[model samples]
Target: MSILYYGLSNSSIDNCTDVDEKVKHHYLPVCYGTIFIIGVVGNITALLVYLVKVRPWKSSTIIMVNLVVTDLLFMICLPFLTYYYSQYDSWMLGIIMCRFTRFIFHFNLYGSILFLTCLAIFRYVAVVHPMHANSIKQKRWGTLACILCWAVAVAEISPIFNQIEMKLQDNKTYCFDLASNNPEFMWPYSWVLTVVGYLVPLVVVCLCYWRIMKELKKGPHKESKKRVRARRLIVLILTCFIVCFLPFHVLRALRIYTRLTPETNCMLDRWAHAAYIISRPIAAVNVILNLLLYTLSGDCFKQAFVEMFRCDRLVSKTKDIVKVAVISKPTTKITHDQSS
Candidate 1:
């Protein structure tokens, strides 16, 4: 989303040509290369650790696994973007690729936010209503909830299918916004996405974590273990969401304001572009952070990593123990025979 914002912002500016194209060409490749490598490795390892090692999945882990999968899917599309930017605003991939890439980008944004919202709600239910939570957090219900999240995300970002287009200029095609020039559509769209994608979800997360913390304070010693774990997870989620998303949304709001006002300052536009570019890498970092959070908060994840790496040693030890038991049985039989 931030990448798209930067591309759109750049397209909006008339004097962008005077800027150093080579710098953009060099920087975008390096930036996207770094993000792609880290994001792919981090998210893939997270998904594998959660799914293969941590079998018998819990609802929280399920949500997290899906989140990692979404992030991975988004990361897969970055190479095309890297190429597009490296070509100095030229898009070599055709119109379909542009639309598909944009779709994946927005899909990750919407899906991740919704899943995080659901995760907070799940925690709230588990902590606030422990007995009822088990009944509600069944596999069937979780599957349904995941389905609903995907449905909502697809529906929300459906506008992009029609709104995005390839712009041709000076015999070069740039994949950017066709609707960004119109304040009538742009401001409302930005606000709607911000509210649905960030504002509402963030409020829910805060409220859920707050209630969870209060409940933990009143619970007994044994429950304290679970509460402390939940609190840490909530804090991690809150921190990631705020740190990664706040700047991007703030820039979006500012961009909308600048669009609505009559006076357009070039300096503000440039700052917005820089903000927009910086936000992309930050968003990618957030995707990677989710994996770290899972490793830290999830017992299953830790146990799985240990077991995965120590499986051969455990197998060898088992074999040695079996051999010792077999030898002792023969000695006991032989001693009995001699005594008889």
Candidate 2:
């Protein structure tokens, strides 16, 4: 979401034009391609695993499935971005497609954040408030939450249609970035985005995990294997937020602030612009982290992956067994929730 915004408009020195086009031209495609490839492969594989093996999804897993879907949604837009940057902001796609891709990217960005927050909260309920968790963490609630997240994210990003425009510059038409050139809309909408979209979710996740940690510290439950795994997953999610999302938001906000504050140092502004650009890809790294969460958070997910890979471990004498396993009709029956 925090992809491309540049230096101040009225800099005493070079302005947004000074924010190295060559670096942006080379950097974005590589980052977008890498993210697209890895996210697509990982999310698709997770979706397949869930569909084929992870039976009877729980509330948390259902949110995770939504996350995978969000990642895939973003993945579909990356190719257009990749091609756009490969030609250095020369948008071959029409204006409608340009705006559509921009919308999808922001939608995925915020949607993923909201879904992750829901995930952490549901997990907190399960770990810290198990007595009431059963009532709160139902599939219906999860489905409703996912729908709400989609609707809210869409509303948050819908204004981009006004902010971004396809403009002609030096005989080339370029689709604007999230950091739109319209000063009227850029900083104001961005500050709102920072507060409501970023900070609110961060605060909620932090609060949920803090309560979970406090609960874990109350007694000998810390020593339990299940609680230990929960602790690990909690740490993982928090790390993704702090390491990936926080820096991006802070740097992007700083960059935008520099753009607004005319008296800002051009050198500092350039550095901040560069830092913000770098942070864009860092935020995208969360998809890989989410893939890790999917594997570790559910025993059925882990078990299915293990079972699928067991064929490699069979010995020469088990060739007949492997053959039978491959050829025989599957007779495994889902008799219960089998979550564990």
Candidate 3:
């Protein structure tokens, strides 16, 4: 999900004035409420699988953990938003919670993108340069990458707090996303985020996956299993990119350009605004899809899930105990025979 879309959903003062109130009063709440339920379940499941079942020090686990954290953080903020929209634009939560909520949304939006980029780069190195993957795939480097991603996401999105505020209008309070208030800053910021934060990373993911597929095709027949797995991961990445982020950037670009136009009328504004409201939820649900994607991408996720839920270890211990009992019984019988 693009932060710009999320900002637009919250900050569009024009929306309260122009778009159909029923969208906010009735339908929007349902969408966000559903998101809240599913996002919480999926993100929590992913978090536990990584934290408990998977080894923390592995490079892949590092990226997966951060991605899950980002999603979980966003899920945590959904209740506040769900309540706000449920009230039909009333915001009794004050400015700080408003800003904090919006800030967390952006943090999740960008943090997910950055961490995914790291995963793509890591996979590229692992597949394309197997021998050298060992050096850069160290836990320390993964930790450093995660820290850098968080720091950069924070720096990029912190200015948003200045643009957002609570508004009292028409007997209702509104948590307004003021991103459009300063068109100059927002326009450039949107472009930078769309390109550098999202587009560039998306391109990198595609390129790496494409290269990986090409290499897989060239390998020997015994590597066919690996090739098939690589293709699945590539498909998963591309599907996620297309479904979650593409519409957001396209609509965002249209929204920005429409705002810049001198002839921007009510009809165009209404369409763009409503489209964003509907599409934002779709993007938000990507966090849930990400958990699914993680499961499909590797056997490690499946094994972790089994470890988290199944009694495999307990069964193994029981078998060991039974073996010990059998051995002792044979030894005692031999001793009794000798004594006799």
Candidate 4:
């Protein structure tokens, strides 16, 4: 994914073909640096707020916590990617790191989509079948669901290990699709990934949310501010998912089509590449936007943010001062202690 972004952007320049040089001096460091700082701080803070302060975890909160962890896992690998890109796509980290990194990327990709889908389904069940939701709203159920999500994600992304291999181009090593040279396998693989990784999951999320919203309108919770906020958050997440993912998938499909055909349409490839480049940043943006959405829409999250920033410190200090004053007595103990 890192290579794709770096190579595609500078594909126009023949002299800048070295992935390591491009990444070392430019691409990898910048992209990885941005992701590391934002992802680490934002996700760690989110996890701490969710776990430490918000102790009584609800089903919804559990899902959000898992999401943060998944994003954090992805962010953890960014430094290696940055180094690889910085070194011009050279995989000095060895095959294990290479495979592990790829696995984590796909794991997060599938895990994120699955969790979002599960969240929508949870909402659907809560709205449309409240009794059923109530029965499975425990922490254990949430844990089980998360475990299943990870399992499925691992199974789905396992193929990436088989498909990805390092190759030397112009005496410089780079990690990219060895499968890209084989259009027959690559096209189908891309299509399958699009369907399983994105399309089907997106459909399920949309449908579940749609049913959930419809039920919400008629249900007893309709008039509550919490319900309103929940609805808005769902809409925000869905909107972010669509906007971040659609262009990338569409461009990928188009690129696959172009690859499978013998006729060279440089124009089409260029346009697709441009779309691919633009979509890469949007994926990271989705991660950052989740924090914004929670901070704005969730009451608990808003309170946690304030506490985390120490905005309440002044008020807390004032209360302590007032307590000290109120507890002070003109009589015995203080005078005795002073004399002693």
Candidate 5:
């Protein structure tokens, strides 16, 4: 989600306040709370399964781990936001924190998507260009690529620092999502984020998956284990793109277009903003869906994930049995004394 969406929420309408603002006040706390809880559990589980269970990590594992790290970082920022929206009138934190918090969300959004794009690219090379896959699949290459993705993400999001500020209006200090003060810059910047951060990666993922699927169909290994993993990976990543990325970008663009245009009816503008509000948290769903992508999508990771969960279940059951035994011992002693 673009940072300024809530800022865009105030809108070009004559009234300083609108329905979007009211909706945001009630909507984001619940959405943020839900995403935060689910994402934390999912990501932490993925982390444990990877860190403790899946040993001897590969290039793809490196990328997936990096993706998880980004999601975790983003998850860390959610509680503060949940609190922010719960008491929507003002920001308890100052501008510096407001800027830092905004930056973390922006960083996670692009970083997770880019890391996911890298996975798609890695799969494309592995399946479609086996001859060169080994060279590109080296651990160092994965590390270098992750470094480059971080650099690019930082450069792309650097502009957000200037766009955001804590606003004091009517004795309330609110940290604006993006300061509405500069529509000239914010409107165009939103498009740049959608294209570079959202659309371009989406196009790349589509092309990669399309080619991978085409190659798999004609190959003899169509039913092979690797092929099955590739197919699953395709489904998971595509779901994320469609559910988490597409709607938010499309709706945000529409909202921006309608807001800036003259002669647009109030109803249309309100609808646009409302749609944008819905899509914002929906886009954040990537952090949750990403847990599936990294675990079930990878070859060794999938096999290991199953074993790890079984191990955890056994451990839990063992603890319960021990607890029961300890309680039974005390009751047996009391009965023996009474009988004597």
Candidate 6:
């Protein structure tokens, strides 16, 4: 999704040949590989905790579960990209897979942003308006919101998937790595992501958090544990936006401008590509960072993990003690029975 428009026009390809593909190929595998391991483990554990440990799921739990689903969906797609970059521009899967990967990528990226925004709003309502919290905090409401988010994301990425083309370059097949052959379709689609998909959710998240923080400062629950956790979550959410989403959207806009404008040259193209390469991995870092956020929010998640392992260890030890008693007490038990 970040590099949906990575290719050069035929004319620009001829004139601007200074970009190095090696840097992207070399760095992307390492970056994506790390994300894959950390994100899979972190998100899977989160899902399990939410599903198995957290009972009678509430709005926040539902929202977090959806967030984990979004992260895992994106994480699952990373290996294919890792393999692609490892192949150094070779795409073996053909056009269908090319489009499929891009669709999933955009869907998860936007889905996460939307879900986070929903969480911010939900929490804000729950905290600022406790009287109305029941209305907003309903599990059914959260489920409906999540369904709407998925529907919107699917609709947004549909156009991009339809426009994806596989290009042959120097005997290697590149999947969705080429600029759209149609500019009319590309610019509008890009705007939808940049404006509606990115900017609107960003503003919504910020606004909700700001209001929530303000309300907490003066509200009766100011010193409550729930309030404190809410504050920490707000901070973490904003941190993710500033560090993860901001750079990618900025560079994505710049990339779009550089690719579309008449004045675009090899120099600007190189700069755009370089900046984008750096920012993209940072955006993907959110999946792993969410794990840290989960741990930092409160002791509940840590406690859950401890309890899960502790129960297993206790069961194993009890079985061992039972085995030892059985091994050592058989003859004594028979003698006692004869005396009785």
Distance from true location, Cα of 5 in model 2, Å: 7.6
Candidate 2's displacement at residue 334, Å, is 53
Residue by residue across 216-285, what tens digits does model 4's lDDT show? 7884757798778778878787976788777767766665565555453445544554454445546555
- Tell me how far candidate 4 lies from the true structure as C-alpha RMSD in angstroms: 8.5
Give the clash total for candidate 3. 1
Residues 57-114 of candidate 6: C-alpha lDDT, one tens digit per residue: 7776677788889899898678998899888768998788888877777777788888
| Model 3, CA-based lDDT | 0.73
Write one digit per residue (lDDT tens) for candidate 1, span 116-207.
Answer: 88888987888789887876566666677788889999988888877777767678887863233345676888788889888999999999
Best-fitting candidate, scored by lDDT: 5
Instruction: Show where candidate 3 strays beyond 4 Å.
Output: 1-20, 178-180, 222-225, 297-299, 311-340
Question: Distance (Å) between predicted and true CA of 115, model 3?
Answer: 0.6
Candidate 4, residue 206: how far the Cα is off, in Å: 1.1
Q: What TM-score do all the candidates reach, one by one? A: 0.80, 0.84, 0.81, 0.77, 0.83, 0.82
Global lDDT scores for all candidate models: 0.73, 0.79, 0.73, 0.69, 0.79, 0.75
| Best-to-worst ranking by TM-score | 2, 5, 6, 3, 1, 4
What RMSD, rounded to one decimal, does every model reach?
9.3, 10.0, 9.9, 8.5, 6.9, 8.8
How does model 4 fare in lDDT? 0.69
Q: After superposition, how far is residue 266 of candidate 4 from its true place, in Å?
A: 3.0
Q: Of the candidates shown, which would achieve the greatest TM-score relative to the real structure?
A: 2
